[model samples]
Target chain A: MNEPILQVNDLHYYYNDNQAALNGISVSIYPGERIAVIGSNGAGKSTFFLNINGVLSPEHGEIFYHGTKITKKSLPELRKNIGIVFQDADNQIIASSVKAEISFGPMNLKLPREEVSRRVNMAMEYMNITEYGDRPPHYLSGGEKKRVAIADIIAMEPDVIIFDEPTAALDPLNAVMLEEVLEKLSAEQKTLLISTHDVDFAYRWAERVLVFCDGQIIADGTPLSVFQNDEVVKKASLTRPVMLDVYEELVRNGLLADAGVYPRDMREFRELIGK
Target chain B: MSHEHTARSHTGRHHHHKGGHRHDTGGSSIDFYACHSRIRHWNPGFRVGFSIILLLFCILANHPAVSCVIILTAAWITVGMGGLSFRRYFSVLTIPITFILLGSAAVAVDFSRQPIGDFHLYLFWGYLYLTYESLLNTLFLILKVFGAVSAMFIMTLSTPSHELFSVLRKARCPSLIVELMHMIYRYIFILMEVQRNMRISAESRLGFGDFKTSCYSFGQIASNLFIIALKKANAYYDAMEARCYDGTFAFLEEEHQANPKHLIAAGIYLTALMSFWLAIR
Candidate 1:
């Protein structure tokens, strides 16, 4: 296939005096891949994202983005290629107005004023938040704020978008909206990497799953395969999606012949039951 | 309710000093300080106009009668229309009212000249004079102070802090100041929690042994708290950078349009204020 867009080789990281947070992890992500990194708290999921984005330097590893080593000298270019959406919308939001916030990233790249305005308009329209253009960040609802946060990065038009727990505090409806946004981004040929504990979100949105445990990549494969392994799930402190759990329970009770009968959506679930 | 209002009046003044302008009472256990969240439903332009009027009234009206009228009207509006109870209103008013009383007393004692023939009471080396002009001036000053204060109270009570920020943004307030206000608003609670935790830890360790020991321990605690706060601030900044923030806040909602009704009301208020000023002149 084509060269990987991002390659991590034997990455190691730590905090507070050599207490390893990421231990010799290696992963390569191809272009336009929707990947989910699942792990419990303190499992180094956040640290890995930090390293990839060049926010934190790794202890003994090389990270390559577009064939260039991710170093301080190359950070500006690396950051331009990869956009990160933080978990806390409050902390990430820095502009006084929505329009300004969305325009900030592109403006920082020294894009022409007209280009910056066009990108801001397009990003806001894509996110369905055109009306909030003049409103202050503080007045937004939690979901709206999250959308703004995403829109901020989207305006930059990065090659890869990394979200750290995008759905952590979002309600079900907002979470679904965010998932749709992610799907759209992936469809647009932008690689999407999300670090989350949201099993259902990962199951539905991720094409490939990377399971992290105690700062190590314990499992990496398709979501279905990674999630099916009981040991990996247990080690990562994650639960299977509700449907998977139900299907497994049904098979255990001899209600179904096999556990491989997975439904992709609610409609499929209903169809599988002939409802 | 009156007692609560009185308490609020007192605490409100103290809060002004404490830099607690953005009263976030949703998760706060302090019932008296609970800000009304319903104000979010009001038309943004109307709220902005109302805020401007309140600010003007506070700055311009100095007479006690006008101030009394302002305070009473605000109280009535908050209680009758805003669905706020007298208790809630009083809780906000208590501290300010105390300050007004204290201020009036001080003015009377320090500045008012005693009428030669009319002495109210004689004390050791002092005579208490009761002058009609002095009393009227003192009362008027007290009323004006309360009036101005109550105007601010009504604005805060009727408008949520977030909405205020939105209005400020729309008004084209300095972006840096607005962002700083927002950050300070959010971090104040975090700092309070940190301070509270630090105090508890210090207490648990029995750091308050004696005068000198307590002072030294307090200094150490303060230093440690500052360092911790700085570290958290740095982490928060890193988190922001990781999220691709390049400075600028975005909102989810559209620009709030000014309502015709609010516009009309604002016009009327402005006309009335000008007329009142003319009458005073």
Candidate 2:
């Protein structure tokens, strides 16, 4: 069995003036797991990620990071391990320049200056943002700012990085760039938890998908199983990835062969169709 | 994806100290070059100290020659040693010149019922006149102000604002003020971006389509922007908290080894400036 890096046991959270955001949520995240969290708006994905990141203390239940229960004393350690790239880069970016912004997370870890510089350089080079090092982050393009936000987490060299709606406001070209960056990070064996409503993105990128509906995990399985389950799709308010839907339609019409394998992404789907 | 600043947006450019100074374009220009400066990582203490001493010399010296020397030296360091463009250097000086010209007008000509002892007299019911002393003082003040402004601009043109704030903190400046300065520097850009987007959206909706409507729409946008800005403030706080910010300074500052050669050069310049001041006084 894969060792769980993050575990939530009956985790519950409620806003002071609103309904329960995470109602008894429990999930175990294995090391290096590429988990895509899918949910409609107000369906508790953000709340769950926040709890795991130690941004919010759950009203009830427990969250364990690397088998250690996350308490106030352990919150800092948990944060160092679980970095979050917020939906809006403008919000996550607090430093004036790109270098300072990326250096922030490492400095927060209280790392030595030399180590911080090395990590900052590595992350910037990884994200292809070395040119923007001294430029004010506020003046950067949306796509550039997003890269800096990701680099901010990468500089910390976190064990797991959570991206909330990573491609929400990104244009198609920049969106592709972001996915490539995520792919590179994943290849390095860093666990990734991305909460997004982009089904095509989730389908192509994620190995495991967790469907959330009304503050509960309605379905959790391989993308094919969870997304193809009609009841789960309806409950989660998610449409199937376009490629998946089209591939299945072709097979249903006897125009294509399944080959006993579900297509994982667009390239695979095309291969399955023999086109 | 379009990283361009929207045209004619009502950002902090029009609201902050020194009107029409844009946080996006104007401030970023200095910040851009400052970051790219060849000696950007030089100890800010030497830079700040040199600038301040030059500024004081410009004030204390009796002759405009001293101010002229100080101004020339500031321009040389910023444009030569720092590698800032000569065009940009000239352009930055224009800012202080505008105010200095406006202010010097008061001293250049005086109004009096009996016509003050004079260089020139013009009738404005009674008389407007100028004296040799007042004229000299006015010219001297303008030169002094320009010299001081140039000296300070050397620091601003070479050192990024955050680094300057970092230098202040190292000098045992109040943490609250330094932190506030840092946050304000960051949020100004945020607010400016919000302003740009709001402007573009408004313009798309015929907000600035006509003369009267444009005025009305601007007022509405301003009010709406205030409310939204407040909401963004709350969001910013939450975002800060997520990053494990504990109401403390959490950013990294560059640690540069103070250059002994630069310090020695600064000392030489200080002596030259003092000798100039004494000779002129």
Collision pairs in model 2: none
What C-alpha RMSD does candidate 1 show over the true interface residues after superposing them? 9.1
Tens digit per residue, CA lDDT, model 2, A1-275:
86699988998889864888888888899998899999999999988887888878899999888888888998888877888888988778887778888887777677888898999999999899998787777557788888998898888888999999999999899888988988888898999999999998888889999998888888888888888899999878799998788778878998887665777676786676665
Instruction: Report fnat in order of the candidates.
Output: 0.21, 0.56
Q: What is the TM-score of chain A alone in each candidate?
A: 0.95, 0.97
Per-residue lDDT over B158-273 for candidate 2, one digit per residue giving the tens place of the 0 to 100 score: 88887888889889999999889888998876776677777778899988989998999889888988998788777677666666666776566667788888888888878877
Off by over 4 Å in 2: A16-18, A270-275, B6-29, B36-41, B81-87, B119-126, B209-215, B277-281
Task: Point out where model 1 deviates above 4 Å.
Answer: A94-145, A228-266, A269-275, B1-98, B110-119, B122-125, B139-179, B189-232, B243-281
lDDT of each: 0.74, 0.81
DockQ of each: 0.18, 0.53
When just chain B is superposed on the true chain B, each candidate scores a TM-score of 0.72, 0.86
